[model samples]
Target: MILILFFCFSFTVDQYIENGRPSADPVVVNPVMEEFDPTKKPEFIIKPRKQFADEGKVAKFKTSFEGVAQVNWERHGQLLQQNDKYKMYPALDFHYLEISSVTAEDAGSYTCIVSNDVGSDTASAVLEVFETFKPSPTPAPKKLELDVKLLDRDVLEGTQQVEFKCKFSNATTVYWLKDGRKLTENERRKMTFDGVFAMLIIKDISCLDIACYECVATSKRGEEVRTSCALTVKRDKQDCNDETGERSKAPEIVSVTPSDLSVKSGEAAMFTVNHTGDTEVKWYRGRREVEPDDRLIIDNKSGVGHFTIQNALPTDQGVYNVIVTNKWGNDSMLVRLHVEDTSIFDGRDVKISTENFEDFYILQDKVGKGRFGTVHKCIEKSSNRLWAAKIIKCKEKQKPDVRNEINIMNGLTHSKVLRLWDAYESPTGFIIVTEFVCGGELFERIVDDDFVLTESDCAHFMHQICEGVCYLHAKNIIHLDLKPENILCIAKSNNLIKIIDFGLARCLQPGDSIKVLFGTPDFIAPEVVNYDEISYATDLWSLGVICYVLLSGWAPFTGETDSETLVNVTQAKYDFDEDIFEDISELAKDFIQKLLVKNKDHRMTIQDCLKHEWLALDTVDGQIMKRLSTDKLKTFIARRKWQVPTPASSLKQSNGGGPSGKAFLNGGADHWHHSHHHRKGHMQTPRSSSYSNGQVPWKKNGNAIQAVNRMIGKFSSLSSNSSISSSSSSSPTSSSSLYSKSKQSS
Candidate 1:
């Protein structure tokens, strides 16, 4: 019964255990375990330190994590990118963030964040980017100070002289003042400054001279310093005597020495007169009273009065009067003083008047024009004589050259050289009045169909040129440019020639080494092209080239281009062409050869050339008297005219109707207009041709001979149809209008 009860209890217990236990299909044992915890949230093993960097440098931030995690970088609370500017490296334990080329904007707080599935750990650091260092600048020196201290003084009335002195330091200018009014230097009052010392002298001081004097000094930096002094005048015995009214005798002139006097400029002149009785003496120039000054002095003592003039000038020439006055009467004497005219330009006696040019002359017609100005035929009003007026526009900078030319021409006196009659200076220009030449240029006569030219005639022309050149050389002057265009005839019927146009002339002193590069290409001397020392012989070379051209109607050194011509001149490359020079005498060729030498020392001088047999009229060979053909000369003149750029209107106005007529006696009316080429500074022979106007054709391989042939062919074809006027006008009709027309076209 008990066993039955136990089984039932056990079954009951089992049923209760089964009902209370968790549901399972089979019985199983569960392993014992603790509560699970995630890996400690990533802890920073090293915190990023603050970084300092300069502009354009690199900055780095690094940190190490205690556990595995993802890493990121942030600046100014913004996530950073791994690009050219920012770079990041993430590893299991180390993390790095790098920045390149740090700038001012890169300075900020940088954060390193490490995160896992649970949480994140972060560290922050500050980045500082500073500008490159630069040192401060030094201070400037202080300005200088000026001291102008003066002393007070007292002087008796009628004192001979009273002076006030002062001193200054580092002052550029100083001025004196009387009672706050500026004091001007005059005859009685004189002001002088030497170095740092200054003085003001008052002569014949009177009661009116009492005043407050001030001196103002100006520093170089424009600062001003000033000081003042008082001047006191005391009563003299002479004033009391005048108030007492003593009886005075009448003044009478006893004798006056030298009633009239004449002196040269810069010379001193004195006049003395004797008078009776006590009197006050005074001197007068014209109607103005003469006072004592640095240049004038007057003294009266012991019944004698003297008036003196120092460093007299032309303006001082006038009538003078001396008067002696007493209480009873006065005596006066009149004297005439004249100061001769002096040289005003470069020690040369060139008198330039400032009066109106129109007052002395009447402009009749416009005859010539050039780059400088215009020329006109004028008639002198007083003499009714014809003269050519060259009106040169004198710019401020160009006045010196014009004045130099005037000085040179004024000193020259020769029959073969053109004469300078007068010169006047105007506000805008200069009017140069010269002798009137009715004839035209030498080449102009050669180009005439009816004109007859012989070797003797050429010799006569050269003789005149040599005479003029010899005269110039005697005065240490060299006419560097000698050409046919510069030779002028006195009249159409006369054989006399005048050498004109001294524009390129120079007055060289002994031992002077001056080199200049300027002249026509065809006539340029070898020394000119070589930049050698120029002497009197340089002009002889040009004369040689002129003779060659006159004989052959072609320039000896002329090539297709100016550069080639220059090269040929430098090498002294020229030959007497048989086609044109066959009839020319051997003596003439010998003269040219002697003068055309490359060495200036070996070149024939003007005096030697004048003695050559070719120039001697008595020794002229029959071959020299032979008539030369004018066809080549006409071709030359036509080619020259064509080469000169001309306006269309110039063709119709060839008969002295154009502005370019024979206006000036000087042959420079077409100076710049006909200049083939004018080069300055150092010269270089070009390997290729450089055509200035684009009218000339380019030559292959710079073949000068081929180019010359082409030019001759081109000009020869047009010579038959070219009817150039051979007027006796010294002006260029085509080139004169060219300058204005070119300006208009531009």
Candidate 2:
């Protein structure tokens, strides 16, 4: 009976639904979406697409949502889904902005968009950054000077607002001096405006007002400009409320930073201040008094006392107290100090922002560092973006070096060359901000390892690098330094390679012969060493060397020292070991031989190398020669031990500037690893019977080394214009996209 009633109820409900029983009133439904083509509507826009610092330090973004809907705030990219209600969020554009934290990393691209049932519009803006300035240079005083003329002795009694003023003509920033040391930003009762002058308003004066005081003045010129003055406050004897208590004896003078405060912990810190007082000055390590030993010398005239531990160690960390004694009173200052390794990086002073390791943060771990400073990973602090930071320490005499790198990088826009996103200068070093490549160095991959790069793969990678270098050469820029260590490679899909590292590069000026032998000897062309006359061809020689090394696993020439290498170079030694060769293609062998020619004039140019049948060979995939051009090798290996060609002589000039490490002209050797040769005896040159008239004895054992050496020497004598004018390449295409689009070298 219950089952039957349930079926009856269900049937009654179904009948009611068929009879159109209303639940909430009938809703109107659109038969169709009216043809409101958003693309056909007037483009919506947000004003002030970027955030602007409209008020002091505050930034504002003005937005206008004007496309058929009343825009509401979209909380985290969500639209209000209620029917018949236009609940949309306000869009942010470049000009109009929503306020967020103006962090150092907040400097990035921001976008805003407006949308309705009919249409939507979008806009973007870049965030420009600025910093809030603070007092840069801090000052410390040696003594307090009093101006009796400026004193108001008439206001002499207790609890009176007596004011003290110290004036200096050269001071832009002034700090209240407590005792002898200048007050810091953390000190109490200090206030200032634009870092001009600090005023300490001591509400009520008492017997203690007789204390000595100093005022330190610091110029805005940062760390260099500073001055100080000292003064004494006086009052009647009755102001000495200490009269009611047992008075202690006054103390003597203690040491200061510049004077008595001098320090020599391996190297002295640039920052220091002076110290002085009344009673006998005695240094103490906490409760233990330090005898005035030889290491603790104090000069009364300078009020400076230099202190050094007999042997500084962990036990030296403690509270140092200086007891000053005089007839009036005994004053003591206890300074808590902790000393560790002096070389500890003190980054706080520079105010460099390096926090994240994602998208442009600083790599503080410092994997390795050199003359250019340090290299580390960087992440964007705000967005957590990652980058590589090359911290180049500024040479005091060559401050413009950093700016030169920045200028060059800022103008470069290439996909193969690492892109520079940002740069900044800190008090510590010049930060070269670049995109991070995780693929490591190419030498560490295929060439340095057992893995091999097929001819086409090699061509693909080399072609890209050549393209980038050619672009630079056309701009008259010569990469003074090029080597495996500096070349970076990464595959986008297991095949792409990118060459980087322009640290030692310089612009090739008109009539500017390379006057400095900066590159390593193995890669250094003959002319670069002998006459310091380098052109784009010098870099070309290095590129050839790179290619040869990659395929052959060794340089063309090698020796135990730079001298032997130079001699070999002079002899024009070609196949030092032909027996060590693998079954490589004759085309490949020919191309390598052409590029490695002892004469720079005869070396195959980049274009010629690319066009060579060796590079045109099909890849391992059996693709056609044309299709093989795009193949990239993805393997990675590392070469830690660099082989630098030893110079012919290590002799110092008779004038005597010490032993010479720099080589103006080196020969007879080139960098080669130990395993470059096959097992057993050195390989002999394969053939020489065809070309030589037998006059030069061109074949093996016919002074082949001497002939090659002379060829290199001849190259050193030839001028650049005379040599490159006959070079085999002259493509003028400036951009890759343009080249592909036109399929022509303009």
Candidate 3:
């Protein structure tokens, strides 16, 4: 046995030397397992432990055998090196392998071998290496800084082409997002990408095309950038989609031009349309076809047609009609142009007013008629501007007066002063075009639609009037005909007052007085009634009368005849009846009293009117500015009209019958004629009492005034009075008639 052992030891040493293994130690084996023992094969209590570790973590694999055993470790069927990175603990009954700083390179199938005297046992496990480290909360992803921008676009509805584009730098791939979501190929949207641009093409754009679009660009380095913009799609509300597809080709009105447009002279006016399908566009001014010239331009392209008029004039103000025609159908739109008078802006320093009378069309109905001329509503064609065109026949006696009126109008530039746009010579002598105050008379506005006139409203309008008059006074011009009819409201929405009628306006030096009797009877000052000197004080007296009428809706002075009216005016016998003036502020009464004083020198100045305590509503007791019942005032006037005698009979009675009858009627003839004409056209019923522009004398004070106020309450059942007098539009001859007739009759 000893000999056999020596031989085996010698043999082991020789084999170890042949395998090139270090041989500092002797080989040890189990003496009993020198021969194979089938019954005592090795088994394991603990096999290699499966491990999950991070890139820099340590992984351990261990195993223990139960029966008599020897253990060894191998990697990928090859012997493993036992060093600092990989270490193995080998024992008689157990063995373990540990790898520190585990790397992807150290991952593979590792096997453990166990041996007994009879046979060996093997166990294998796989080590999977993932690109990711031990999981942690993900850090914020890096953002791309690529140069990218999206261009915005506007498109019309119906069969239209629309595109969205994005420009980028160094883009690897590009895509689109519609309304915050990824865009894809669909029936309505088509997306494409070029070298550095991304595009979303939409065919047949509709209201649905209105959306925000985004373009996303990604680089080869995995960086991403994006840009976005909104798409505006305008569609015609009336041109709805055909449910049955029957009116597909019909030319429909997309949007009609504004029903009314007010343009200043020498400005441009544009009318535009958008419709579906192919069509031809035609334009007309009144009944005449519009031919394009240097001032008139027509543009029709890509479903849009535009009509523009440059350098618009008073003659350009009128109703314009656009006719759009196609094989399917035809449609039309009307635009009314209201041209503002620019002639008032002309002066020594200003340019000449447009004299093209062809721009304006005169309506047949006359607003006023007198010895001087007739006034008609004229419209400018291109701008839809409205003007009061006064057609005057050339008379040898009226030339200087007309020239003076024009010169005064041309020199004034206050916003509250009526603007005279143009004066043109024609076969009918001359046509003076003035701004059309669409809001009508100030009294008319007060009575409209249950509108309650507050003291603030009064102050507001009064302030404007004072400012305009102040401007006129500074220029040494006096408006002898200032009245409710002459004071026109700028518009219905506002209380802006514009003083009209320069025909009665006379530029006077300070202290200069005109002896020729002028001004309406009711509004004429005491000095004028006494045949005294007429100065700026006369205008103040008229303003006081207007204020009284506005507050109480009754003339301050009224009588059965012009003589009685003149007597009351000359005496300054107007009184504020408490019943009618109960709501009026004491400050307002004071203001009116100051103006209506018998002494013209003591009357309120325009400056004093502006500084009146009544106008200071913001600082005074709020109760004083309470709203007045305009309904009550309108009702009172309606009843007074029925009670008063007919103006025609009164005028005829004042003047004996004459062939000319030129000076045969009293001053009330103009007002009566204008009121009657207005009533015939608008108010078909028994007309309300006409507010005379001439001497309107009230009954002797006290009980008489009380009787009129009481009667007004009972007259509340009458219909709305639609009549508006254009006494402010009278000619020079009629203007003087008011003063001359009152003086003659008295």
Candidate 4:
């Protein structure tokens, strides 16, 4: 048995050696089995760690695994793909995920999944996104102050040269004027400025050069400081005697053109005097001599004297006098200059009266109150006609806005638009006179229990509104704030309506697009909420909301909160409730539908609205006329009154909140209601007992006033940073997308 076992072991050993021996011809083996291991799995060699990134910055995650594996990326269990926003790279042992233009929504836990047939492993890291820093509000510029005044100078008639000097502070440029005409550098005249000092030198001075000399300094902010001095030229006795015993006689006036001149603002006005004189003439406005600036010119020739005003302003309206002297008797003639009010298209300056408002009209009881001013009913002293006067405090910061409104109102001539009679600027404030609207707001009329409103009536009102809007659109003007509160009737019994309040209106030029952060919450367009380019369709959207409210007593986009309402507007998430819209005709629904489209290009134009079949429909389905119930409208108005938040609440909400929260806190529901009731040209309701007795009640709620003031302040602050005009094409963005972008850039 031992011999047999030894022989078997020796054979086995010889067989093993034969099988394991190296040879020039290599023995083949199973390559997969040689490298494979049953217990092997993916193990992280370098795991991603927690990272922090600023919004709008790039974020990257990297990992390396020891075993062969396929790599994938996920955020909160949702698989991520390589697209414009995301990118992924995989190698044999390394993987990478990169996100571009990171936003607040990208902040979360990111996972890198590695898997193979054997097993799988995941490495997660938290990504913290932070907002970029925002710039602080710019402070108001300092007012330019004048420090010195020009002094009078005397020179001989044949003096070789004369110089006038003046000093000023905060002046960016200085201009020299003679008899109200701007001076230019020539052979005989020279002007020089050395920092704070301005000088004017005239060579070969003659009698004609003897007139009022003015030094006008202007700052970069357009603030002007003016000073004047008279230049008296002493004549030689021999020239006056003229080699005779009798002295030279003064010129005699023959004729004067335009003895009393009347011209519109921004128009050119000229007064020519035909006289027999050998000397020069000087012009004067009141006691002060008229200075020839860029817009005023004075000329004296062989036999005539002319005074011309170019682009006349309201302040230029006055009595002008011209005097001619030839060393003998002097002749003088006076002419009155009147400048009529012009539109913004004609001139930026509005004709404002320095006279007291009470001088022209008898101030009566207070009729209304607003965020910036108070309204009063007045009677024209000359015509005994009734009018409404809006009095606003003349704060330096608000003057431009008030003047802009006046200019816009002056430009409008349509009967359906509010008419501006006059405007007065006083020491303390401004008083604007407009047509008296006693019929109250459209909502007030709708709420009246005895008032009957039919679908046809709604159409008639809409027709008038469309006509007004069409006229405005033709002029490139868009009334951004169009609502029931802005529509006023001529009389309680008539259907005639007038649109008011141009504070939010804009005149868009070709290829102009503006983005502003202001509007009534219930009527704001989706573009407004998304901070996209605003166009004429913005007004059409408001019209659609107005029509919707008229037909159904509820707001289409109203929600429990302002932010929610904004979200609804951006998504166009409103439906026609059966209870409120069942009685409405299909054509009417179509009209509103066309106007309320989210894409501005798809919205109906003003001309289309005017020509729509619904406005021309006399009867619906050839049936009896249907009257809408006022109960819902009354409820809506009541709800609006209570929706205004107190100032304290707005302040609390604005503090320590996110971007959306702060925006809503500043210009959301509270601002909408406040602006609705307190806008310029708002009419008081006649339902109040005080109004019935010819004494309109001045309602003053402490909380309401405080809230309105706060709203106005908020508007001023935001307006400084809002309304950006861009040349880039506009693309529609959802509310959530805008929110994320705002967070990333705030």
- Quick one: best TM-score, which candidate? 3
Which lDDT tens digits does candidate 4 get at residues 555-615? 9998666545656787787889998877788899999999999999999999999999999
Q: Number of the top candidate by lDDT?
A: 4
lDDT of 1 by residue, 1-746 (tens): 55554454345334333434312221111111322234656668789999999999999887775544556778878987657787665322345677899988999899988777777888999999998876777554235454557877766667899988888777777889885579999999999888588789999987567666878878656788787676655542222236657745567667777667888754567889999878888876534577564346587897998887654556667656676777665556556677886522223355899999888899866665664576676777875555667787655654665676677788776767776778998878688876555456677766677677888888988898999999999998887667666677655444777777665567777656655444556676766555456789988998998888888888887765444565677779789888889889888899999999988999888899999988986335567667888777777665655564322112222111232332122222222111112234534432223334423232222222122222323333443323212111122211122111111121
In order, candidate lDDTs are 0.64, 0.42, 0.60, 0.65
lDDT value, residue 177 of candidate 4: 77
lDDT of 3 by residue, 1-746 (tens): 65675565456446434344323222223222245344777766677766676677788887766454555668877877656777655434335677888889878888988776677888887776554556898765444454556666655567567877767766778888765468789887888887666788888976455555778888767887878665655444244345765435557667756656888865668888776668898776533568764346689886788887654666677667676767545566556678897643555232233466765564533555545555665566755555566666765544555667787887676778877677776444667766554445677678877576777788777778888989999998888767665677655434666787676677777444453233455666666545455677778888888788777777778654444555577668878888878767788889888988888888888898988877767533665557777765676445432333332222211112111111122223223211111111243321212223322212221111111112122123222331111122223433222111111122
Least accurate 10 contiguous residues by lDDT in model 3: 701-710
**Backbone collision count in every prediction?**
1, 100, 35, 8
True-vs-predicted CA distance for residue 223, candidate 2, Å: 69
Q: Write the per-residue lDDT of candidate 2 for residues 656-740, one digit (tens) a residue.
A: 2121111211111122100011112433221211214321222111112122223345445434322201100011100111101
Ranking by lDDT: 4, 1, 3, 2
The candidate, 1 or 3, that scores higher on lDDT is 1
Candidate 1 lowest-lDDT run of ten:
23-32
Candidate 1 residue-wise lDDT at 343: 27
Report lDDT (Cα) of residue 526, candidate 4: 82
Question: Over 4 Å off in model 4, which ranges?
Answer: 1-350, 644-669, 672-746
